[model samples]
Target chain A: MDILKEISENLELGDFEKVSLLTKKAIEEKIPVEKILKFGLIGGMDIVGEKYKTHQIFLPDVLMSARAMHAGMDVLKPFFIREGMPNSGKVILGTIQGDLHDIGKNLVGIMLKGAGFEVIDLGTDVSPEKFIETAKKEAAYIIGMSALLTTTMPMMRKVVELLKKEGLEDKVKTIIGGAPVSKDFAQSIGADAYGYDSTDAVESVRKLFNQA
Target chain B: MRPVLRFLEDELIERIVSEARDVLCKLGVEIHNKDVLSMLGEHGAKVNMDKYHVLFTNEIIDKALKTVPKSFKLYDVLGNQTHDFSGYDVYYTPGSAALNILDYDTNKIRRPETSDYIKFTKVVSGLKNIASQSTALIPADIHEKISDSYRLYLSLLFCEKPVVTGAFTIEAFEIMKELQIAVRGTEKELAQKPLTIFSCCPTSPVKWSDVTSQNLLDCSRFSIPVEFIAMPLSGFMAPVTLVGTLIQHTAETLSGVVISQLTNPGAPVLYGGSPAIFDLRFETTPMGAVETEMIDCAYNEIGKYLGMPTQAYISLSDSKQVDAQAGLESSMGATLAALSGINNIAGPGMLDFESCQSTEKLVLDNEICGMTLRMLKGIVPREDFPTLPRLEELLKEKHLLISEHTRKYLKEEFYFPSSVIDRANRTRWEKEGRVTLIKRAHAEVEKLTRDYAPSRLPEDIKKELTKLMMGEARRYDMKRLPEIEI
Candidate 1:
């Protein structure tokens, strides 16, 4: 069997150790880093995501598979850097300022990373300047903001405004989420997208890349 | 026999009540309101002002229980008594204070404004099985300072039924009384023909905060029935064991009852609760969980044993959307609450762990309530003698499909669900586009609104209410409320 297929199957089984070993063996056997990432780790996570969407697997099962995929990604990440190749793309995420809630944002981050995106999680209470600075530093394409409070939903709009002021409006896509944030609010604030939940966040990022 | 659901034996209920009294006497309840503390102290409660504790003796609780009437009547807008909380009469009201509403037209969830509250009130007013209306959606357009009183004003303006609502602050509580008095004409008449029952809650772990305790006292003084809602999050703010939580719940409720009765000897009170097990994984109170239904049933048993009219937060779904989980959890909780003989079940139309309100869910839950109440009625054999002869005579025919007995009792015996619950075969259902419950609910809402005429109110009273509400708005530095076309 192909090594990428083996790695994908092991990741599906949530056999992190096996995924790591197979990924390393594939590395040592001279498979390209980008090829291993796209055909193996991302391929495995795509199946897990679909399984989640279809209700075939729940949070715990998907989380276990995500960890296994991450294990494989860890083995392949340094090789990609050494070979001067991007994994998928960079994305910056955080719960917006005045909001201390991050569980939903963290879930989105995990899903993004599982989808093979290199996520720079800015954590909670992130200001618009912080998001912009991190997005600039990471050269991230998408900036995802989450706010659990209605009072802090405007911070998402401020971040978008800041991006526009910095002339980065066309360069970076912005997505907002949390309990109170909605698609209408996203449109009202001129955000590039709105993610109703964590899985929708990953899909929004994918759609952004596709549109680009 | 009537369908009955009980979780605890009479002995166990007594034991739980006994332990609850011990909890109150030993640990004591924390009452933050100074007036209530002083009042409790005057009533021979062991009050520690510095510690904010009021320890109730068996004498205090027994006296209070003796004075608390087993049932009371709630009146509607026209000063007609509508709700009789006498015995096993269970009524369903929608969940209260939801910040967001699912807009039927947009099919989007949004923070509701006053217009949306009006829409919700109209929909609820039309739902026949829903016994009372609640301020199901909080308007986001109003200022926080006036929101509570403003919501009460809207309830008075729109709902003709007895309202189930409450106030956030002492000022808001006073304003609510003013609105009630304006509707009922005078303070004495307000007390006599109470058009609303105020729900006052005690914080979990046996604590009654200053505001809520004061609201309890205010309601008692006004002669409005107060629903003492004790929400104990099991395993977190409350004890992990169901019995342990019940002990806390009973203690909290008993303390409220004692204070309320002391304030006014014959004040009406409802023993209501909204308890849920703290889910370790989700870190949420699953209002629709089986554990919640069990707790509601058990707590209600204690209420009945104490001869108090009871209420429970049931018919609520934890599901974010109206789907299978929503149907399963909501129907299960509603059925359990109904069978348990809870006097008032207040959670229809609530979703997302009771955070979001949906009129569609309310319509759907009206159907659920109808089914559950039908189940609660059980089967009533009309004739004293066995119908074996009639059955034999019917069986002699080719079929009993058109028997005289069947024709006589068919509609009376079974609850035929309205158009929302599809009972048609697959062929006919698909031919009719296989509409889902939510879509059907949307259609129901549309039909109701299109056919809607404002409930009759005297023109003078209407103008007075408008003037009073506008006066409130002007106090918040506004000329009038935001307008929406009726």
Candidate 2:
């Protein structure tokens, strides 16, 4: 009875168990892994993102969808690696050093993952060097830093300076965000962009790659 | 005799208060300030340091309630008593901290500047029914760092009424407290008269941020009157039911009371809230919603039962313009809040969910407030012990227009609205250019601003206020303060 449709519907409902079961069932039926990942998993998340953007759904609903998507993706990851299905992009995200606030950063991570971007979340209190070293190691397309305190806002500037010194500014784009961060602060620090909120973070990343 | 509105019976109020106390004792409230958390711990509360939660026992709650004054008095800049925030005596002030002003000329909402703030102060100063002036508009021309204190400075310079103000940052409180002191000369005199009432809001669903908690502690230390604005959006941040929201409001407010009383016993606080029904369709908190007003009245009853002065952000509209929607919503809110005996009714000149302020609407709401105050003075016999005498006099005169009884009680019995109410007949209305309510309100705003005299504060006090504000502005890299015509 249309196993991929069942998977997508279950993902949207945030039923992680049913989504995982349907993904395993689709794989057993010998449907191509790419079709399940695209039409089954990412298809459901796109709806969640749009509903969130329009305020038809709220944060809890979006977070539940992200969880359901992860459960299905866990089962599909091995198949994709074997078949070499490429993700849209990779991003490195973290809260700058001396700032412990991470709720906003975590929400952006969830939304980025829902949008089909592979997000490497370096947890809160991450140093500037850790952000760049990991970006260079993982070859991330964008590096996102967050700072909730005015004191820790300077760390974002340090990350930008290190990126310039290493001449990786052309290859890797930088985006700064937090309660105290603004577009003017971003320009003054020589960063590529500033994200006003979590939803805006996804759009900013897409703009950096000319994907929007 | 005063008309009163009661939404909850004694049994229901007792049940609700019991439930709130149980929630506070069992679930506890999360306070982000370290000093407050430890202080609560020292005061016999069960403190969960790891989670920053404090559980209050019945004894602690009772002790705090006993010390809270049932009422307080507010003094104007000249040390004249302006407001008695005691039982059933309602006072109207403009809503505070609006980021936008509904520009009279453009008929559009835009970021307010210092000039707009000055004009708002001038208009509020001229308003008769609005008892106190609020630091209502946040001027965009100033630095965000000093916006909180700057609003107060403008209100003190251009207006004389006791201000209803608040601070956004913990550091800003020092300057705000100093500004109040500059008016009254010293901390002791300032505390004695208490020229300002600070609004300290707790985060909804039983939590207080570090900044707001610190502000409460500081206000308590100086004996400054504070109103705990606990905003719980029903169906969203709070339970979907009205009673459930009331419980949350009670618990949040009680936690603030305990904090203040712990800092200094007998600290004055008003049981205030700004709860709204979160409209699922629009994803907005409509303050003017009927259920929102019901929550306000119900909680005011609870506050009165608890023996504390009450405040609410009612008598305001969520409408984007000063249209029929604004008038109806605001009138309904004012009537309900006044009958419910909310002592400080802080919602005039407010629109767009309290984000925008219009001086034109302030003029209209002033009349609404006057009507409500008149309604509060329910049908009472003035000089007519026998109704037959009044009827005979009315029958003899054929009209009571020039009779002694009419002359004595005409102003008392009837609320005379300004020209904004459109009392004239259609023919006369047409003769006067057939002006709409908006046009009439705009003209009144212009007349008030033009007729406003500069504040009568002593020249040295004015100079001192300017110097202190200039020092604060310079700290944020602003070289000069904005010029005011006065």
Candidate 3:
């Protein structure tokens, strides 16, 4: 990958061609995927994630970063498909039903990518049935959920219960996060993890993987 | 200092109280939900929940009013005396209420960098006319090297008067100590000159956060004065009537008084409230309207009646723009706050219904503060008339009253605007950039931010606070920060 393009894409500050060009450059140069993941994606996302936490950037920045991350990821998608393998872990994510906010969930997705995990972002307001079905089909190891509004935090509990009812709870790890979600709250809701931000979300997933 | 201003003398206060009283007794204030009604009834208030209205006899009102304390002190780390709200003028700002500008990197609004916060505070501090300044905006420019006490460091590095602020966590409070140490020169001194950090209770009838409660206790034990700021949305959260709102305010105040005095009686507690009806039409809380005047008059009376010093939110507004509406609201609010003898007023530099802060308004409001002081001076009587044998000499030469003494009186009594604001004739005013007050204000803010000199803090103390903030920032593994040009 063109180092500049990949770095800019991973940073979430640029657009599609920025990442495509960087990826194409790296591919032409025969640079390994592992090095591209660490130097470009990891480096870029580190900047974006910290900025989000400090009020220097807002939701629009998060969206832009996610788009860039995807642009870079798109080039790597085919290589992974050809190899028929996934790096790190497979995680499924969504904003619980009734909560339409996607900012926090999207950041978590970007951070997960930076952490070298494949994240299936189930766009917000996802129902219990959809979560169970996705977990089954993707056979994802980690279940990451986010909620921004207080009114929708309870869905975290409901989704967890529904997963148990479908007998998928033990089969997969469940984590919950959002503005309203607390560490104590996560325990009360019977979720395996609780994250307050993108960094916490990544850390929790890493811990989950370590324990497994 | 001028023996407390009377709300009755303030025309706006009178208008607001009478209008609110009529609205309550006639149309009545909305109780809205049954929960609020039930809560009031439990406190001996008569509630017509179906109509969403409440009525309280003087007896219930009195009982609630008795619960509040009149005066409170804010202490710095040295426990050096800074402000006493009961009978002094105190001015502060909002608690960074909205999640605006953030660090481009972390994207969290933890704190703005020390340099930025200092610049912001210096503008207010140098004004000197401002009584108290509480600005706890996070420093974003600082890299995520967490453990640094950004808020405390900046307040310590800049401000001179009492700073109204709060702690988000215990670690943050430790940093606050470092900030305090930096200002007062010694830990022992800051402990003695403990600051009057303001704690905000939930907006009406809501339980105080456990964290907030704990912080209050901690501040109390340290001899730091505490001010309980109860912000109730009249049409939304509290009573719809002026009197009912006072009762709600009374309950909130009384509970804090009990807690404050319970922990440290005469612990220098001040009673204050920032309540106004929510203008549902605009989806905003009108803080500087007649509604705000009523709030100041009634609640201040409750505090004064209890023989305790008081404070309230003045210099407020619900105008969405920094236009005539902004001027009207802020002017009226500042008048009410001063007239009612409030010890502290937060945020007068707001426009667009208090949604935005403008530097021009800051400069303009500084002028207004001077005007309000003149108004409080009240009508000058014959006592200062000088019997003017000198003026009489000039009168002897004139047909009527254009005497030199009269000229002197006119020149001395009338307050003049500074050159930045156009007070000149239209012909000349058109030449100076046609610059509106806001444009001038923006320029002023930029200048102040750049020219501000950081408060000289003791090196060790500054280092300690910085360490705490930077360390705390890092626990969350906060690394990079946004690049802010300003």
Candidate 4:
């Protein structure tokens, strides 16, 4: 079997150790760093994402494959930095203030990482000011907010307003997603995009950067 | 011969209990309240102050279990015993704390106001099969700060049944306790015959929030009966496996038991939970899912093993409307919960993952509850031992419909549902306007609301309740409460 094909298959199977070992062996065998990342790591995640979007696999399966892809990425990261290859983009993610639900937020973070975007997760109950400060400090390209409670959803509007007040709305796009959030709510709150679920969150982020 | 259902065998029950104790000792539970942490530290448990985690020894768990009353009685506002949560008897109540209500008129899910809650209370009071009334809907008209106490106040006024309620904030408990005390005339009298059971839920994955922790402690301090709502969403907040979820449920519930017992020994509590299976497709917790129902029954077995009265949020549906799915899911849940012999069975009239409640569905579920309760009586020889005599009477009369034995056991042997259940022949059904279940339920709701007489509370107590509620309502900048015809 081709070594890259073996790596992609292992990553798809969520065999992190095997994927990492194969990526290391491929690196030792003089495979280009970009080829290892694209054909080996991203190649496996693309299939996982497609399967997830098609409902052929569930969230847990997608999350496992993401972990395996990260294992492969760990081996290719130093090489990518040495070669100055850019990542997908940096996105700041968190559950809005007064809400302790982070599962949806964490799933979005995992999918963003699986899609090759850099995710700075601030965890749950994150205030609006913290989101703005993090985006400014990280120079992030997007701010994604999640909320599971209708009560805490209004806090998402605060984050959007803060982005405008800080004059970062043009620079850092804001996207919101959760069970209680809707496209109408996002538009009402002046948000740039609304993600219906984790899969749509990635697509929305891609669209925000005109990469879709 | 009463029919019963057991989801776990003796050995599995032991294993689950032992594992839950092990989890408490090893993993411990994170409590957000510092006072609780210090209290646990004082009680000889290993308390991690920095993390607010308390690791309990088996000795502490055993001590708490011994103090928990195996059974307790719930009383109505008139001081009449409404429920005896002992033996294998099961009682049904509507599920609580829904954000929205399915409007019977509009056929839409909308936020409930004070009037909606009053109508709910009035309807619940007339429900013969459902034994207790819950503070089911959160009224959106009131200030969120007073919403918790407002529901309790309304329930007390409009209904005489024992209330199943909980507080959202620590301050709300004071007013709620005051309301109960006013009804019972004193703190000691209220505790003696508890008029309410506060639901103190522990956050899944073995954690307790500050507000919920305080509510648990307050209920314990007053010796008010509490049901520890250990809501472990399977495969999401908790483990993927059923047994894994049970262990988390046990651990979380035991942690609550320890807190309540340590605070005030002999605190009345019911081992209860609202566990649901996570639907991966929609990312929703479907309470009506079979796995969720199994989790509810399985935990009831565990609760029984611990010698505590059990409560479960079963007999509910995830359907958006009162349709076939609602009927199927709710009847399945009610039947299973009844067979399991859960002491306090909640989730009647609940829909959309317990986020919405429907009065039409409540009327429908009352029939379901009546049927399930009759099933619990089981088949027994009721004067049928002398089969020859009844056979002769049937043969002589060519029908036994008016016979002595048939007439005697008519009400006992059969569950006669209300008009909500369509049991008539096709001709009669069509003659009765060809009404749907939702339509019949709408008629029933209106009839029940119209027929409900005023509650029998004394005039002085009624005035006291109004005074107390108005005082709290004014604190939230409200001058007047909603108008109720009753």
Native-interface RMSD of candidate 2: 28.7
Query: What lDDT is reached at residue A67 by model 2?
Result: 77
Q: List the residue pairs that clash in candidate 4.
A: none
Q: How far off is residue B68 in model 3, in Å? A: 8.9
For B1-486, candidate 1 gives per-residue lDDT tens digits of: 887877999999989999999999988899999999999889898989998988889998999999998999888888888899978889999999998887767767899998888888888888888989997888999888788888878777777889999988887887788778878889999888778888899998899999999999999998999999999999998999999889889988888999899999889989999999999998999999898889988999999899899999988999888788988998999988998899989999999878899988888999999999888778888552687877787557423433456656666677867678986544345646989888998888776767666757565776787778788778789766878553
Docking class of 3: incorrect
Tell me what fraction of the real C-alpha contacts between chains A and B each candidate also makes: 0.00, 0.00, 0.00, 0.00
Give Cα distance to truth, residue B100, candidate 1, Å. Answer: 1.3
All candidates: TM-score: 0.68, 0.69, 0.54, 0.69
Candidate 1 residue A71 C-alpha distance from true site, Å: 84
- At residue A74, candidate 2 shows an lDDT of 89
Give candidate 3's error at residue A95 in angstroms.
Answer: 81
User: Alpha carbon lDDT of residue A159, candidate 3?
Assistant: 75
Q: Any runs in candidate 1 off by more than 4 Å, and if so which?
A: A1-212, B105-108, B383-404, B484-486
* lDDT at B243, model 4: 97
Instruction: Give all candidates' CA lDDT scores.
Output: 0.86, 0.90, 0.62, 0.90
In candidate 2, stretches whose alpha carbon ends up further than 4 angstroms from where it belongs are A1-212, B387-391
**TM-score attained by chain A of model 3:** 0.71
Q: What is the DockQ score of candidate 3, to 2 decimals?
A: 0.00
Every model's TM-score on chain B: 0.96, 0.98, 0.73, 0.99
* Order by TM-score, highest first: 4, 2, 1, 3
